[model samples]
Target: MTQQPAADPFPPPSAPPAQQFAVPPPSPSGRWQPERVDPLPGTEFGLVQLRVMPITSGLAIGSLIAGIGSILVSFLVLCFGITGADSGWGGWVSGAFTLLSVVFGAGAVVLGLVARRQIRRSGHTGQVRFTGGGMAISGLVCGCAGAGIALLSLALALVLQVSS
Candidate 1:
Protein backbone atom coordinates (compact mmCIF):
# COMPACT_ATOMS: atom_id res chain seq x y z
CA MET A 1 0.00 0.00 0.00
CA THR A 2 1.44 3.50 -0.85
CA GLN A 3 1.83 5.85 2.11
CA GLN A 4 0.21 9.14 1.18
CA PRO A 5 1.64 12.29 2.70
CA ALA A 6 -0.55 13.56 5.55
CA ALA A 7 -2.97 16.22 4.39
CA ASP A 8 -1.84 19.72 5.35
CA PRO A 9 -3.74 21.08 8.37
CA PHE A 10 -3.26 24.71 7.16
CA PRO A 11 -3.34 25.41 3.50
CA PRO A 12 -1.56 28.39 1.89
CA PRO A 13 -3.82 31.42 1.39
CA SER A 14 -4.98 31.99 -2.17
CA ALA A 15 -5.36 35.82 -1.59
CA PRO A 16 -3.21 38.34 -3.49
CA PRO A 17 0.16 39.23 -1.82
CA ALA A 18 0.76 42.66 -0.26
CA GLN A 19 2.87 45.26 -2.01
CA GLN A 20 6.63 45.12 -1.36
CA PHE A 21 8.95 48.10 -0.75
CA ALA A 22 11.96 48.57 -3.08
CA VAL A 23 15.18 50.49 -2.34
CA PRO A 24 16.28 53.10 -4.88
CA PRO A 25 19.58 52.62 -6.67
CA PRO A 26 22.64 54.54 -5.46
CA SER A 27 23.56 57.80 -7.25
CA PRO A 28 26.52 58.22 -9.64
CA SER A 29 28.60 59.68 -6.80
CA GLY A 30 28.24 56.39 -4.90
CA ARG A 31 26.20 58.01 -2.15
CA TRP A 32 22.75 56.75 -1.42
CA GLN A 33 20.13 59.46 -1.79
CA PRO A 34 17.82 59.86 1.12
CA GLU A 35 14.42 58.45 0.43
CA ARG A 36 11.41 60.66 1.12
CA VAL A 37 8.83 58.83 3.15
CA ASP A 38 5.23 59.88 2.95
CA PRO A 39 3.61 60.79 6.18
CA LEU A 40 0.54 59.02 7.43
CA PRO A 41 -2.82 60.42 6.48
CA GLY A 42 -3.63 63.68 8.38
CA THR A 43 0.01 63.96 9.57
CA GLU A 44 2.29 66.88 8.74
CA PHE A 45 6.07 66.61 8.29
CA GLY A 46 8.79 69.24 8.03
CA LEU A 47 12.20 69.19 6.44
CA VAL A 48 15.11 68.95 8.92
CA GLN A 49 18.39 70.70 8.25
CA LEU A 50 21.61 69.96 10.06
CA ARG A 51 22.84 72.77 12.30
CA VAL A 52 26.38 73.38 13.48
CA MET A 53 27.21 74.80 16.90
CA PRO A 54 30.15 76.93 17.88
CA ILE A 55 33.07 75.36 19.72
CA THR A 56 34.10 76.28 23.25
CA SER A 57 37.44 77.87 23.98
CA GLY A 58 40.09 75.59 25.46
CA LEU A 59 41.57 78.41 27.52
CA ALA A 60 38.23 78.98 29.18
CA ILE A 61 38.08 75.34 30.19
CA GLY A 62 41.61 75.43 31.51
CA SER A 63 40.87 78.57 33.46
CA LEU A 64 37.84 77.01 35.09
CA ILE A 65 39.87 73.97 36.12
CA ALA A 66 42.69 76.05 37.52
CA GLY A 67 40.31 78.26 39.43
CA ILE A 68 38.60 75.26 41.02
CA GLY A 69 41.96 73.75 41.94
CA SER A 70 43.01 77.00 43.56
CA ILE A 71 39.85 77.17 45.61
CA LEU A 72 40.27 73.60 46.78
CA VAL A 73 43.86 74.15 47.82
CA SER A 74 42.87 77.29 49.63
CA PHE A 75 40.26 75.34 51.53
CA LEU A 76 42.89 72.78 52.42
CA VAL A 77 45.07 75.51 53.83
CA LEU A 78 42.18 76.78 55.91
CA CYS A 79 41.44 73.31 57.20
CA PHE A 80 45.04 72.71 58.21
CA GLY A 81 45.17 76.04 59.98
CA ILE A 82 41.97 75.38 61.81
CA THR A 83 43.10 71.93 62.85
CA GLY A 84 46.30 73.40 64.36
CA ALA A 85 48.42 71.05 62.26
CA ASP A 86 50.90 73.70 61.15
CA SER A 87 53.86 72.35 63.06
CA GLY A 88 57.05 70.93 61.58
CA TRP A 89 56.30 69.08 58.34
CA GLY A 90 52.64 70.08 58.51
CA GLY A 91 53.61 73.71 58.43
CA TRP A 92 55.75 73.17 55.37
CA VAL A 93 52.96 71.24 53.67
CA SER A 94 50.48 73.95 54.48
CA GLY A 95 52.81 76.57 53.09
CA ALA A 96 53.23 74.56 49.91
CA PHE A 97 49.49 74.30 49.44
CA THR A 98 49.13 78.03 50.02
CA LEU A 99 51.73 78.73 47.38
CA LEU A 100 50.04 76.31 45.02
CA SER A 101 46.71 77.99 45.61
CA VAL A 102 48.19 81.36 44.74
CA VAL A 103 49.82 79.98 41.60
CA PHE A 104 46.67 78.22 40.46
CA GLY A 105 44.61 81.31 41.19
CA ALA A 106 46.94 83.47 39.13
CA GLY A 107 46.93 80.96 36.31
CA ALA A 108 43.15 80.79 36.34
CA VAL A 109 42.88 84.56 36.19
CA VAL A 110 45.29 84.76 33.24
CA LEU A 111 43.71 81.92 31.35
CA GLY A 112 40.20 83.23 31.89
CA LEU A 113 41.14 86.66 30.56
CA VAL A 114 42.83 85.12 27.54
CA ALA A 115 39.91 82.80 26.91
CA ARG A 116 37.42 85.66 27.08
CA ARG A 117 39.48 87.69 24.64
CA GLN A 118 39.79 84.76 22.29
CA ILE A 119 36.08 84.11 22.48
CA ARG A 120 35.39 87.71 21.67
CA ARG A 121 37.71 87.61 18.66
CA SER A 122 36.55 84.24 17.44
CA GLY A 123 35.11 83.96 13.92
CA HIS A 124 36.64 87.30 12.93
CA THR A 125 39.40 85.61 10.92
CA GLY A 126 37.21 82.88 9.46
CA GLN A 127 37.88 80.72 12.51
CA VAL A 128 35.21 78.74 14.26
CA ARG A 129 33.16 80.75 16.69
CA PHE A 130 34.03 80.18 20.32
CA THR A 131 31.66 80.01 23.24
CA GLY A 132 32.40 80.00 26.97
CA GLY A 133 32.31 83.63 27.87
CA GLY A 134 30.31 82.72 30.95
CA MET A 135 32.81 80.05 31.89
CA ALA A 136 35.66 82.51 31.58
CA ILE A 137 33.88 85.00 33.78
CA SER A 138 33.17 82.39 36.40
CA GLY A 139 36.76 81.24 36.30
CA LEU A 140 37.96 84.76 36.82
CA VAL A 141 35.66 85.22 39.79
CA CYS A 142 36.69 81.94 41.36
CA GLY A 143 40.35 82.73 40.79
CA CYS A 144 40.01 86.04 42.55
CA ALA A 145 38.13 84.48 45.45
CA GLY A 146 40.70 81.74 45.82
CA ALA A 147 43.60 84.15 45.71
CA GLY A 148 41.94 86.41 48.25
CA ILE A 149 41.31 83.54 50.63
CA ALA A 150 44.89 82.34 50.36
CA LEU A 151 46.24 85.80 51.05
CA LEU A 152 43.95 86.27 54.00
CA SER A 153 45.03 82.95 55.43
CA LEU A 154 48.65 83.94 55.02
CA ALA A 155 48.01 87.25 56.75
CA LEU A 156 46.25 85.56 59.65
CA ALA A 157 49.09 83.09 60.01
CA LEU A 158 51.57 85.91 60.11
CA VAL A 159 49.56 87.84 62.68
CA LEU A 160 49.35 84.77 64.91
CA GLN A 161 53.09 84.18 64.56
CA VAL A 162 53.84 87.79 65.43
CA SER A 163 51.62 87.74 68.47
CA SER A 164 53.30 84.53 69.74
Candidate 2:
Protein backbone atom coordinates (compact mmCIF):
# COMPACT_ATOMS: atom_id res chain seq x y z
CA MET A 1 0.00 0.00 0.00
CA THR A 2 1.29 3.41 -1.00
CA GLN A 3 1.46 5.54 2.14
CA GLN A 4 1.76 9.27 1.52
CA PRO A 5 3.70 11.13 4.24
CA ALA A 6 1.23 12.57 6.64
CA ALA A 7 0.61 16.22 5.78
CA ASP A 8 2.56 18.66 7.96
CA PRO A 9 0.09 20.01 10.55
CA PHE A 10 1.60 23.46 11.36
CA PRO A 11 0.47 26.50 9.37
CA PRO A 12 3.22 28.53 7.63
CA PRO A 13 4.49 31.55 9.51
CA SER A 14 3.28 34.89 8.05
CA ALA A 15 6.10 37.51 8.37
CA PRO A 16 9.74 37.24 7.45
CA PRO A 17 12.51 38.39 9.90
CA ALA A 18 14.03 40.88 7.43
CA GLN A 19 11.25 43.46 7.77
CA GLN A 20 11.83 44.31 11.50
CA PHE A 21 13.64 47.53 12.34
CA ALA A 22 14.60 48.87 15.84
CA VAL A 23 12.51 51.78 17.10
CA PRO A 24 14.31 54.91 18.25
CA PRO A 25 13.51 56.70 21.47
CA PRO A 26 10.90 59.42 21.52
CA SER A 27 11.98 63.09 21.75
CA PRO A 28 11.99 64.72 25.14
CA SER A 29 8.68 66.21 26.29
CA GLY A 30 10.62 68.72 28.40
CA ARG A 31 9.01 67.71 31.69
CA TRP A 32 11.44 65.14 33.03
CA GLN A 33 14.70 66.26 31.52
CA PRO A 34 15.08 69.71 30.19
CA GLU A 35 18.71 69.16 29.28
CA ARG A 36 19.75 65.61 30.14
CA VAL A 37 19.29 63.39 33.15
CA ASP A 38 21.15 60.36 31.81
CA PRO A 39 21.44 58.15 28.79
CA LEU A 40 18.32 56.23 27.86
CA PRO A 41 18.03 52.66 29.06
CA GLY A 42 17.78 49.75 26.66
CA THR A 43 14.33 48.81 27.94
CA GLU A 44 11.13 50.79 27.65
CA PHE A 45 8.20 51.99 29.84
CA GLY A 46 9.89 52.79 33.18
CA LEU A 47 11.24 56.31 32.99
CA VAL A 48 10.39 58.78 35.80
CA GLN A 49 9.69 62.51 35.50
CA LEU A 50 10.71 65.24 37.87
CA ARG A 51 8.52 68.26 38.42
CA VAL A 52 9.56 71.89 38.87
CA MET A 53 7.77 72.13 42.20
CA PRO A 54 6.15 69.80 44.70
CA ILE A 55 3.21 71.07 46.75
CA THR A 56 2.36 68.75 49.65
CA SER A 57 5.83 68.66 51.13
CA GLY A 58 5.94 72.40 51.15
CA LEU A 59 2.71 72.65 53.13
CA ALA A 60 3.79 69.99 55.60
CA ILE A 61 7.16 71.53 56.44
CA GLY A 62 5.94 75.12 56.38
CA SER A 63 3.00 74.44 58.68
CA LEU A 64 5.15 72.62 61.21
CA ILE A 65 7.90 75.24 61.38
CA ALA A 66 5.49 78.14 61.51
CA GLY A 67 3.29 76.46 64.11
CA ILE A 68 6.27 75.84 66.38
CA GLY A 69 7.38 79.41 65.90
CA SER A 70 3.98 80.71 66.84
CA ILE A 71 3.93 78.61 69.99
CA LEU A 72 7.41 79.76 70.93
CA VAL A 73 6.51 83.38 70.49
CA SER A 74 3.54 82.99 72.78
CA PHE A 75 5.71 81.22 75.32
CA LEU A 76 8.28 84.01 75.13
CA VAL A 77 5.60 86.58 75.86
CA LEU A 78 4.50 84.63 78.90
CA CYS A 79 8.07 84.16 79.95
CA PHE A 80 8.63 87.91 79.64
CA GLY A 81 5.73 88.57 82.01
CA ILE A 82 3.13 90.23 79.84
CA THR A 83 0.34 91.66 81.97
CA GLY A 84 -2.56 94.11 82.07
CA ALA A 85 -1.84 97.53 80.56
CA ASP A 86 0.10 98.97 83.47
CA SER A 87 3.78 98.56 82.52
CA GLY A 88 5.98 99.56 79.55
CA TRP A 89 7.70 96.15 79.47
CA GLY A 90 4.31 94.48 79.15
CA GLY A 91 3.61 96.43 75.94
CA TRP A 92 6.94 95.37 74.47
CA VAL A 93 6.23 91.76 75.37
CA SER A 94 2.80 91.90 73.72
CA GLY A 95 4.27 93.45 70.56
CA ALA A 96 6.96 90.82 70.28
CA PHE A 97 4.45 88.00 70.65
CA THR A 98 2.16 89.56 68.06
CA LEU A 99 5.07 89.89 65.62
CA LEU A 100 5.93 86.24 66.02
CA SER A 101 2.32 85.28 65.44
CA VAL A 102 2.17 87.34 62.26
CA VAL A 103 5.42 85.85 60.87
CA PHE A 104 4.39 82.29 61.59
CA GLY A 105 0.87 82.82 60.32
CA ALA A 106 2.11 84.40 57.10
CA GLY A 107 4.68 81.65 56.50
CA ALA A 108 1.99 79.01 56.86
CA VAL A 109 -0.30 80.82 54.48
CA VAL A 110 2.40 81.25 51.84
CA LEU A 111 3.50 77.65 52.06
CA GLY A 112 -0.07 76.47 51.70
CA LEU A 113 -0.46 78.48 48.54
CA VAL A 114 2.79 77.11 47.14
CA ALA A 115 1.67 73.55 47.84
CA ARG A 116 -1.55 74.14 45.96
CA ARG A 117 0.37 75.54 43.02
CA GLN A 118 2.71 72.55 42.85
CA ILE A 119 -0.20 70.13 42.99
CA ARG A 120 -1.86 71.92 40.14
CA ARG A 121 1.28 72.14 37.97
CA SER A 122 2.19 68.48 38.35
CA GLY A 123 -1.32 67.32 37.42
CA HIS A 124 -1.74 65.52 40.76
CA THR A 125 0.19 62.39 39.86
CA GLY A 126 3.94 61.87 40.41
CA GLN A 127 6.74 59.88 41.92
CA VAL A 128 6.63 59.02 45.64
CA ARG A 129 9.48 61.40 46.37
CA PHE A 130 7.66 64.27 44.73
CA THR A 131 4.37 63.53 46.47
CA GLY A 132 6.04 63.05 49.83
CA GLY A 133 7.84 66.34 49.58
CA GLY A 134 4.60 68.12 48.86
CA MET A 135 2.93 66.40 51.78
CA ALA A 136 5.76 67.35 54.13
CA ILE A 137 5.46 70.96 53.08
CA SER A 138 1.72 70.90 53.70
CA GLY A 139 2.21 69.41 57.14
CA LEU A 140 4.57 72.23 58.00
CA VAL A 141 1.98 74.79 56.98
CA CYS A 142 -0.65 73.11 59.13
CA GLY A 143 1.77 72.93 62.02
CA CYS A 144 2.32 76.65 61.74
CA ALA A 145 -1.40 77.28 61.72
CA GLY A 146 -1.75 75.08 64.78
CA ALA A 147 1.03 76.94 66.50
CA GLY A 148 -0.71 80.20 65.83
CA ILE A 149 -3.89 78.78 67.30
CA ALA A 150 -1.94 77.43 70.23
CA LEU A 151 -0.38 80.82 70.78
CA LEU A 152 -3.82 82.35 71.09
CA SER A 153 -4.86 79.61 73.48
CA LEU A 154 -1.70 80.10 75.49
CA ALA A 155 -2.44 83.78 75.76
CA LEU A 156 -5.76 82.94 77.33
CA ALA A 157 -4.22 80.31 79.57
CA LEU A 158 -1.55 82.71 80.71
CA VAL A 159 -4.10 85.36 81.56
CA LEU A 160 -6.14 82.81 83.49
CA GLN A 161 -3.08 81.52 85.24
CA VAL A 162 -2.02 85.00 86.23
CA SER A 163 -5.50 85.86 87.46
CA SER A 164 -5.84 82.70 89.50
- Per-model TM values vs. the true structure: 0.62, 0.43
lDDT of 2 by residue, 33-141 (tens): 3222333344332333444443245555565566566666656655554453344455456556667666776676676666656555554434333354445455455
**All candidates' lDDT scores?**
0.73, 0.53
How many pairs collide in each candidate, listed in order? 0, 31
- The positional error of residue 6 in candidate 2, measured at the CA in angstroms, is 54
lDDT per residue (tens digit) for residues 1-164 in model 1: 99999999999645432221133345587643433433333333323222234798999999999999999988887766544443434455457778999999999999999999999887643346899999999899989899889777765655454454
RMSD of each: 13.0, 11.4
Weakest 10 consecutive residues of candidate 2 by summed lDDT: 16-25
